[model samples]
Target: MANTKQAVPDTLPLLRDRIDSIDSQIQALINERAQCAQKVAEVKLAEQGGDAVVFYRPEREAQVLRRVMERNEGPLGNEEMAKIFRQIMSSCLALEKPMRIAFLGPEGTFTQQAALKHFGKSIVSAPMAAIDEVFREVESGAANYGVVPVENSTEGVVNHTLDSFRDSRLKICGEVEVRIHHHLLISPHSNADEVTHIYSHQQSLAQCRAWLDRYWPHAERVAVSSNAEAARLAAEAGKNGRAVAAIAGEVAGEMYGLMTVSANIEDRPDNTTRFLIVGNQEVPASGKDKTSLLISAKNEPGALYHLLEAFERHGVDMTRLETRPSLMSRWGYIFYIDFVGHYQEEGCQAAIAELRDRASEVKVLGSYPVAVL
Candidate 1:
């Protein structure tokens, strides 16, 4: 046993040395790649002119991440490997030009997290107070892109986001899915046992309905503008000697300097939220892509059926279908649809043409690469 222990200790130093050597090589290669990215930027500037340069390509980035996953063969999982590559790509892209992303937030919100997750931490994030502001930021060229919550697995769709698309010319450039794990947080100055009021976003309150009912039925549930706002309110209340707790995610809790009283208190274990990246330009096909469209059928019988029949005939898989009231006319409905395949493809083009003929109006929001990371 002593000999075996001695052998293990001796091998550790050699293994660490090899790892250090590999790390040095990796660092050198990364810098070399960064230099290449800088050169690419110079070439693009010379060709496209300074004012019109676009450094980030959503389609290309998605393709690269997908290729990384496809070719990965390692002890590390595919997603773990892709994340490492994601940072590397993000750093390289920063060398070209840092991306500015707008998201719905007061900072420390899940939309902010989704923005970082989709665009990487290297981006400069601008927090907008409302979903429309996020869209406007991207539309007015103040931000390169915007991230907004589309739907949650437990809480259905974010109607605000759907409604924002009704008149917006901004396109869906990318998407990200983030797993949500809510935590019960108390301010550092407050006691968990003395909590009188619970604060959270209305959606979050609904998500943890059963859990809250089971554990703190007597506590007053206050719906705030956002989870981050709830955390801020809870932190302030704690300092003022009020027994208030916030239900929020880790980012908000940490940002507000609150202590976790209970972790992962969400009603469903697989709770996840989907966010969309909105930008001014339409993304080209990335091989595996999804297209979003807004269609309004004639206010008549079989209007909806005729609009959907084209996609079925073309074998285009429709992933999501949502109905929202049309702002153009009272009592009229518009269909927000998402389907697999890019608009540039033959199958999708044919399907869309048929829909345009059958429906009153058909607008292609965007065709973007599916989420890779």
Candidate 2:
């Protein structure tokens, strides 16, 4: 058996004192870091001479988070350690200048979750009604950056987001992946057994289709604008004596003051969604990076073959290839390609040079640091 001293760590009061000392040290160090960040802002402003000074550096933050994970030893996991540093960096950056972030929402949506994940909660979040509105918000300078869902692991790409990219000139500054956990939620006054109507976003409903099919097969599954909206509707319906439940994330449930009838009701175990960060500033190469391109290949038969060949010949890694119908011509289509390495790198540059020569048009969407967390 373990010794009582080893197991109990002596006394609670002594432990509390040690914790209090550590807390004081942590607070002092954090203030010192914030002061350094303030100096950085002053330096940048002095050099740039006005509002042209840029504050947030996604690559720098990613590097710091990666180092935090690498250097972490023990009681906490790597992600947990990184999360602590992420918030600290967020607070320090806020001391420099608080950023405004836009996302698809009425708040409490997965996109909002992603926005917070990528930029941290120190930002001022602007909830946009639609994907296009998110683009417009950032484009018009209403928000410094925007977050939108690009694809879900189970359901595939968000067509609306991809479609929005065709017209907008926003850059893909970074990426974040959010694990989706859906719950069957109801108001406190709701009778769980009496649920006759179910509400959720179409994607969320489809994600939890199998579970819903097996349990409440007869409940009318109504698709709404967003999961948060569904939660709001369920809250309203319960007060009116209607038996309604919504399939949404925990954030939505808390926001709408609803209780979870069933947690993690999704059919798949790993229902993850990837969101893209859209902004105006171009991110510099961050060692490990990915480049996105919008290519319009000629209608000729061998056009796509030539584009693919360029990447193969240069020994460049291609990660994603998505096709969208071109708005300019009826028969033509736009190809969205994502590949490893920054566009400025020699290999990527050679490959892209070859792509432009073979294709009718080529647009470099953005080359950004790969997601670190």
Best by lDDT: 1
Scanning candidate 1 in windows of ten residues, the lowest lDDT window is 1-10
Q: Write the per-residue lDDT of candidate 1 for residues 1-373, one digit (tens) a residue.
A: 1321233334778878766766787899889989999999999899999678878889999998899899988778899988988888899998899998999998999999998887777989799999999999989999999999999999999999999988899999999999999999999999899998999999999999999999999999999999999999999999998879999999999999999999999999999999999987878889899999999878888889988899999999999999998877887899999999999899999999999998889999999999997
**Model 2 lDDT at residue 343:** 93
Off by over 4 Å in 1: 1-10
lDDT of 2 by residue, 1-373 (tens): 1221243345889777766766787798889999999999999899987757889898888889988998888579999888888899988998999999999998999999998888878989899999999999999989989999998988888989888877789999999999999999999878999998999999999999899999999999999999999999999998998879999999999999999899999899999999999999889888889999999989988888899999999999999999988878898888999999999999999999999899988988899889888
Overlapping backbone residue pairs in candidate 1 total 0
lDDT of 2 at 102: 91
Screening candidate 1 with a backbone cut-off below 3 angstroms (N, C-alpha, C), the clashing residue pairs are none
TM-score, candidate 2, is: 0.95
TM-scores for candidates 1 onward, in order: 0.96, 0.95
Give lDDT per model, in order.
0.91, 0.91
After superposing candidate 2 on the true structure, give the runs of residues whose Cα lies further than 4 Å from its correct spot: 1-9
